[model samples]
Target: MKNIISTIAFLFITINLISQENNQMKLGDKIGEFSALDDQGNVWKSTSAKSDFLVVYFYPAAMTGGCTKQACAYRDDKASFDELGVTVIGISGDEVKNLKYFKDSYQLNFPLLSDNEGTISKIFGVPANKGGEITREIDGENFLLVRSITTPRWTFILNKERKVIYKNAEVNAVEDSKNVKEIIKNYSK
Candidate 1:
């Protein structure tokens, strides 16, 4: 029994290590293929959206202070982003319904994707939210459920070839769009 347990532990450890190593997303690396449900309840494949540049960002949650600020900043600069032919997509672990509400409420023009499973977040190496729970009452019965984890505040700028040209692990919410513009300007030269 002891040997069997030890072998199981070793296998688990090895698998965890391999997953961690595969989750590293760095500059110059093309994003892994992912399909996510967007705010409109449409399945969007990352490869389907091609442009001169693509900005894939992960935020903690929908309708939150920091996340709202970051999203609106991008919305307000739509013209500038459009001028540069950059497509911005924001990802969060929020459900598709919540994402739609947030987008409609904020008048967000870009795509907001649901990452409730944390698969996309893991692939990007962004830390997922640790704890949260929700209690739902349906018709008279009450049920407690753990909330989906959110992703870290990070952004990636990819070039035409879909290779990451710039990555910001710690993004400044309000100033992130401007910073990305600066990087794009420098990068285009």
Candidate 2:
């Protein structure tokens, strides 16, 4: 009985590890279709994007220092990205309400997806942890922002074929947009 129990435990562990490994995406991997709610409460579908390239960037949280910088950088580079035939999307565990506030605060022009359940992050193999909350003053009132999970900054670019062409696990928040733009430019050449 003891031996049988041990074998069962080993099998369970192995299966779990294998499943996790399968979810971790790599370059050249074809991304499966996904959809989530955008900050404006609209359903954004992967298959609906008509751009030549798709930029999917995951940030830890909304209204944070590093995340704000990364998002703003992307915002500032919107024109360049549009010119390159790229559609940039930022995903975070924040709720749609929080995402709306963040977008409005920064005047961000791109779509921000709310991945409150971490399902999207898991699909992209981005590391995620427990959710957190922070308070911020937007005028004269303090608003509490909550998240369901926190993901490390990661970026992936998919070509028109829906295959990942670039993956950056260790991303520099301030330089991420610039780096991705250059990468895409060079790739086009």
Candidate 3:
């Protein structure tokens, strides 16, 4: 009986393990090759995206403090990021409704993709379990897993040819803008 219980618990953990940031993406690596649905439920093949620069950021949850600040910072810096030929994108597991609230709350003007199915999360390798802030009761026992990986708080920069020009995967929000700007300054044509 103990083994049966352990097996079930382990299965849960394993399945949920998909969300963490695997970052198959590497510096100077080509743009993503997979397709994902946009906020409007429209299918987008990354190949169809036309931009001199692209900034794809993955975050953990919507409406949360840290996530909100990072997203809003990106939102507030649209012009500068744009002036440098950059397009910003955000991915998260938050449901569509919640995302709408968040976008409205900040009056953000960018595409926010919903990874509720976690396919995009797996592609970007953003940790599925974002610490123990969320909990579930199973068989009257509360199960908790540390996520602490929400959004992985990283950014990717791709040139017109879809080759990565700047990669900032370990930046802190307070200094992320500086780092992104620096990348643009150093690499812009």
Candidate 4:
């Protein structure tokens, strides 16, 4: 009985925390800034950030379909974002090696932040997989997926003031491109 009670309490607390993290809006939410190592072993953080605007996004894994599409979209459109003076930072639980592959494979122009211990992912409210096992599918084939359980997909548009001007909590990498474009167009300094 005591064990059951403790488990129930734990679940309740977990659910509440998930809810709070998942409900974050890109704008107006206080994002705790931290340093993440980039591909070249360079550390990127608020103190050393070099851009008029910043886009911080969290995803489930390194090379999944949705995650890939989203990342590639950003990769392919680096110039436009640069023209708008927006800097991009991507976060995931993948190790630096995997992040290197993802960047090299896609020729990602932006810095990929490593959160191997998932400490940073959790700080951003990115969810963890329910089971310890990470699984996914490619072309309808079963595969072992190693990433957090679920990531709260979001885009934060920080203006020159470092204040979030726009946020997209509901993420669709394909469809959200329009929003991304507009925010940069409007907020680009």
Candidate 5:
């Protein structure tokens, strides 16, 4: 009985490790190709994002504190990114309308894609919550509303060759663009 239990435990551990390995994207790995809807309702195909490099960031939600900080950081550094010939794309599971509001409110210079089904998050190995709904109060009345899946803070810098040159599973919200800039500068050389 003890031997059988040990075998079962080993199987469980091995399965868990395999699952995580399947989801992770390591350095030098090519990013999986994807096409999704941006905030403006236009299709963005990975093949068509003509640029020297692409900065793909996955954030938890729109209008939230850390997400906003990260978005604004990208926005504030737009000129520098443009100078480097890099294009930034932010992805979240929020509704398209909410993402639009977030962009307009923050004056974000880049496109924010709505990944409502968590497809992009899964492809990028970002942790995402399963879809659900929640009740919220608005002017003293409770209303049921859909909740966007939450994604862990993550960023991937893909070169023109579509290979991931740099990846950060744990991102610092305030210093995100600077970090990306430094990485780009070093990697470009």
Candidate 6:
């Protein structure tokens, strides 16, 4: 009985380690193709991005201060991003409905993906915690937004070859788009 229990524990640990190893991503790593539901409830796939670079940013939640600022910054800089041939995507653990609300509220131009299960966050090695609910007043109506997990602000830039060229774990919400533009400018040169 003791040997069986110990063997089972060993197997569990090994499996967990293997899973983490497979999901872990870092600078220079080529991210595998992935797809998720966007704010419009349409499927967004990595392979569908037609750009010289791709920006994948993970934020904690929707209807929050920092996330809103970050998203708005991106939306405001859509022209610049397009000129630079860069596609921007924001990922969060929020539900699809919540993502739609966020995008609609802010008039976000970029894709906001629903990573409600934290699978994409795990692949990017972004830390996530248990999710909760937040009530926000929108147009005189109180809406409850729930998320499956909360991921810290993190950003990654992938080159045309899909290799991670830049990774920012400590991102400045408001300056994220500006900083990314600078990085892309320099990287292009």
Highest-scoring model, lDDT: 2
Rank by lDDT (best first): 2, 6, 5, 1, 4, 3
List where candidate 2 sits over 4 angstroms from the true fold: 1-18
lDDT of 5: 0.84
Regions more than 4 Å wrong, model 1:
1-22, 131-147
lDDT of 2 at 29: 93
Candidate 1 clash pair list: none
Looking at candidate 4, the ten consecutive residues that score lowest on lDDT are 130-139
Best by TM-score: 2
TM-score for all models, in order of appearance: 0.82, 0.90, 0.71, 0.76, 0.83, 0.89
Q: What's the residue-level lDDT of 177 in candidate 6?
A: 96
- lDDT of candidates 1 onward, in order: 0.84, 0.93, 0.67, 0.69, 0.84, 0.93
Q: After superposition, how far is residue 18 of candidate 2 from its true place, in Å?
A: 5.5
What would the per-residue lDDT of candidate 3 be over residues 1-189, giving only the tens digit for each residue? 999999999988776554343455666677567665565666656666576777777777766667778888888888888778777778776665555656766788888876666676566554455432454343465544223334466667777888767666675766666677777778864
Clashes of 3: 20
Residue 29, candidate 1: alpha-carbon lDDT: 84
Report how far off residue 160 is in candidate 1 (Å): 1.0
Candidate with better TM-score, 3 vs 4: 4
Task: Give me the runs in candidate 3 sitting further than 4 Å from their true place.
Answer: 1-23, 130-151
Instruction: Supply the TM-score for candidate 6.
Output: 0.89
lDDT of 1 by residue, 1-189 (tens): 999999999999899768766777888888768889999999999888777998989988777789889999999998998888899999988778767767887899999998888888787777676635445443466545343886679999989988889888889999999999889878888
Error of 1 at 2 (Å): 12
TM-score-best of 3 and 5: 5
